[model samples]
Target: MILVTGGAGYIGTHVVRSLIRHGMDVVVYDRRPLPQPLLDGKPFLPVPFVVADLADRQALDETFEKYEFEAVIHLAGDIVVSESVAEPEKYYLNNVGGGMSLLAAMRRYGVMKIVFSSTAALFGLPERVPILEDDPVRPINPYGRTKWMFEQMLDDYDRAYGLKFVSLRYFNASGADSSGLIGEAHDPETHLIPLVLEVPLQKRPYVSIFGTDYDTPDGTAIRDYIHVSDLAEAHVLAVKYLRDASESRCYNLGNGRGHSVREVIATAEEVVGASIRTVETPRRPGDAERLIAGNERIINELSWKPNYNDLNVIVESAWRWHKGQN
Candidate 1:
């Protein structure tokens, strides 16, 4: 059976759905209570949901004791970059401290494999465009620093013990399930697509454009936004690769296609049939100028082909999800 930490959140929930679709026994451990969509009555409900925090070692030990989990996809970590900057200690506690606790639990049990959800922030201020996996790790924020620290921990664990793992450093994860059953729903969403879509839905007053004078074509930041479904599919493959006893690997999950902030807003307007009010603001601290992932490794190694590569397709999927929520 596969255990998913933080599987109740936007990305983890989709991972659970994809794992179930692939006929894998799955259980979700999330600090937050499972939303109504993942509840038993929903048609698109995935696997069993268990509300547990990885930060609590006792709870994690109990969970490991109860399930004969062969592999675990660790996604339960504090992710808000702004929040992390405000409270670096919190990120360390949750991302680093909680990660250590989970690793200890896995050691206590015989669980040998893990697929971690890492971020592109680990490669802050890329030395070159299309950042590679081996790029020097220099994170500009606490959130990215925490992820990098865990990667190092994974290496340590691998050397001392025989804990094999895969760390998928994702660029920018957007979009939602094609079926619109589950989607991004954060208390204060920071992702671009959803924030723009929310403007048309009147959920937010306007979308903020941070740094409108970058060296890009549109004078704005360029990012590689991989669809959520595609990311989930990669996780499934990562789990399978581990189950096959493959060596520990790292893959960058992205479309290899870059989209500017202006282009994203324009596409969102077209998809939602309404213009998004915009406001210019000073560049967000620690925000990179441009980030486009070098997905050749994942493409060649994992054979990951993103179906929703087009910007319009990405925006349309997210638009459907936002409208459904209304």
Candidate 2:
């Protein structure tokens, strides 16, 4: 059985569904309760779930004792970049410290494989567009630093203890499950697509464009957005790759295409058939002009290609899910 941490969250839930679809026995270890109305209906209700923080060593040990996890999909971590900056201690403790506890439990249980949900933030300010796995990692914020630190730990553990790992550095994970049963739902939503769609949903009056003076073609920041299901597929492939191979690997997951903020808003407008009001605001500090992923590594190595590569398709899927919620 595979253990998925943070399996109740946005990306985690999608990955859980994907794993179940692949006929894998899955168990979720998350602090949050399982979301009601499981996405694909009653089938998801039978999956085992353990509610506990990763920092709780006893909980981790008990969970390991209860389930024979062949591999772990680690996604439980502090994700808010701005919050990480404000409360570095929270990020370090839960992200880095909690990971250490998890590793310790894995060592005791003899579970040797993991699929980590890494981020492109590790690249920081990239030297060029289409970031590669070999790019110099100089994370500027606490969130990115914590992820990079865990990755370094993974490298050491792999060399010393034979703990195999696959780190999938995701770009921008957008969209919802095609089934439309579950999707991105955050308290203070920060993702671009969801925040933009909120305007049309009447949740907000207007979406704020952080900056319009960027050097991109549209004079707005550009980012690569990958559908959540595609990311889930990559995680499954990574798990299989590690099970067969001895060496650890890291790959960037994206569409290999960058879309500006203006372009995304325009696409959302087209998808929802409503003009999204926008207000230009000054660029936030450390905001990169463009951040796109170089996905050739995953494509070539794992034969994984994104099915929802189109921005309109991504926006439409997100719209459908968000509209259903309202």
lDDT for each of the candidates? 0.88, 0.91
Which residue segments of model 2 deviate by more than 4 Å?
A: 38-45
How well does model 2 score by local distance difference test? 0.91
- Root-mean-square deviation of candidate 2: 1.2
Scored against the true structure, residue 303 in model 1 reaches a CA lDDT of 81
Off by over 4 Å in 1: 38-42
- Residues 1-326, candidate 1: write the lDDT tens digits: 99999998999988988998999998888998655563456557546777878877788887888889989999999889999888999999999999999999999998989999999999988978788998888999999999999999998898889899999999889998988778988877888998898888888899999999888898889999999999999999899888776479988888887899999999988887887899988787677888989999988988888988889998898888889999
Q: lDDT tens string, model 2, 126-203? A: 989889989899999999999999999999999999999999999999999888877898867889999999998899
TM-score of each: 0.97, 0.98
Can you list the residue pairs that collide in candidate 2? none
